[model samples]
Target chain A: MKNRLKVLRAERDWTQAELAAALKVSRQTINAIEKGKFDPSLPLAFKAARLFELSIEDIFQDEVTP
Target chain B: MKERTTEAGDFTACNVKNNVRLLSWVFAWVVTLVLADKAELYEWHSSAFISIAAIVINAAIGLGVIVVFMRHLKGLDELQRKIQLDALALSMGVGLVGSFTYSLLVTAKFVIDAEVTDIILLMTLTYVVGVIVGQVRYR
Candidate 1:
């Protein structure tokens, strides 16, 4: 999956650590997600969506899907 | 946005508390094990009762370590938990494989004077390596 997490965080002037603090996760997790090396679980994806005030699809796009 | 209620990163207060508990339990377990082994080796207690007591105490501390470790894992973030679980699985695999292979070698008269502690040390080293690899990969 590809995500706009980096772009979104940049737009909000939020560092990875700040975003991770908000999500109750480690900064490494956020970095891995942003780098497309790791995929978030459902609850974490939902949490990110809620934080961004957007749907999951709006944030993460499946590379092979419509 | 939900208000940030605590400090950033993975070291939350609950996590720190559980870590401390786990560390203490592990320390106690190691101390009890060493004391029991030394007492047995030196014949410090001729009574079976003292040996039994040592075993019981050691087991209780080991149980405490397991419980505290489980709680700590539960409180960790998903990625951390996954890494831990993976490392645990790898360690378990190493333990089983190493023990059986050693047993086979001993039975075949290819090796001699082996102990369970050696296998345990191997498993521990494998677990540490697994955790380090997982952390580095995710980082």
Candidate 2:
């Protein structure tokens, strides 16, 4: 999975720590999601979507579409 | 004054307490083992009460470690918890197979001087490896 988390964060001029605090997760988790090293769980993804006021599909995309 | 974070990667306030508790658990294990060894070697068994006290102390320390370990596991995030669960499962499987193999060899009259401590050490090593493998797979 790929996500536009970095772009969204950058648009808001938010640091990873700031975003993580809002999302109730550690900064490492945000970094991992941004780097594509880790995929967030559904609840976390929903939290991120709610935080950014965007749909999950708008934030995340499948790397290999069916 | 600012709160200090230990090198264990616990960022939350609750995690700080958990880290300190974990450190105390390790300290207690070392102290209990040393005391137990001394009790066994020296003449601490001169009194039945003293002997029983030592055994009780050892058991209490072991139980404390287990309790603290479970609490620490409960505090992990979902992904980390998954990794730990998988690691524990793999380690347990390896430990059982290794112990069963050694027991069979012992039954076959093979002269193996392995003790329970050796099995415990092997299991610990296996858990460490399992955790590393899980982390690598996720990373």
Candidate 3:
């Protein structure tokens, strides 16, 4: 899975720590997700979507599918 | 977001408190054991009080450590829990196989001087390695 997390966070001027705080996760988790080292679970993806006010599809794309 | 941050902060604080408490208990338990061992070795077989105290304190501290560990595990996210479970399973498998192998070797007279502590240490080392491997696999 690939995601626009970094771009979205940048647009909102939110640091990884700030985003992690918002999501109730450790900063390492956010970093891992942004770096494509780990994929978020559906609930976490939904949380991110809610945070950014965007659909999950807008923030995350399935690289394997394409 | 603000509410969630506050919750996270609280969780971190709680984790730190639990960690500190657990460490303190373990430190006290180890110190007591060392002192007791030293007294026993020096022919200071004074009273059964020291032995009893050591046993009681160690059991209490061991229980505390387990409680804290379980609480910490319960607090982890799903993926984190899966990684930990995998690590634990791998460690247990290694521990069992290594113990049996060592026993067989001893029975065959292929090795000597193997003590119970060696198996405990081996299991601890394997568990640590398992944790590292599990983390890397998830990452």
Best by lDDT: 1
Candidate 3 per-residue lDDT over residues B1-139, each given as its tens digit = 5676776677667657766776777687777767777877895777888777866777777787788778777776555666678778877888899899999999999989989878878877877788788677656
DockQ values of all predictions: 0.55, 0.30, 0.32
Per-prediction TM-score, please?
0.93, 0.79, 0.78
Off by over 4 Å in 2: A62-64, B1-10, B135-139
Interface RMSD of each: 3.0, 6.2, 2.8
| lDDT accuracy of residue B7 in candidate 3 | 69
* Better model by TM-score: candidate 1 vs candidate 3: 1
TM-score of chain A of each: 0.96, 0.95, 0.96
The collision pairs in model 1 are: none
What tier of docking accuracy does candidate 1 attain?
A: medium
Encode model 2's per-residue lDDT on A1-66: one tens digit a residue.
999999999998877777766765566667778999888898989988988899999999889967
The C-alpha RMSD of each candidate to the native structure, in angstroms, is: 1.9, 4.1, 3.2
State the weakest 10-residue window (summed lDDT) of model 2 chain A. A20-29
* Window of ten residues with lowest summed lDDT in model 1 chain B: B1-10
Candidate 2 local distance difference test against the native = 0.79
Chain B TM-score for all candidates, comma-separated: 0.90, 0.81, 0.81
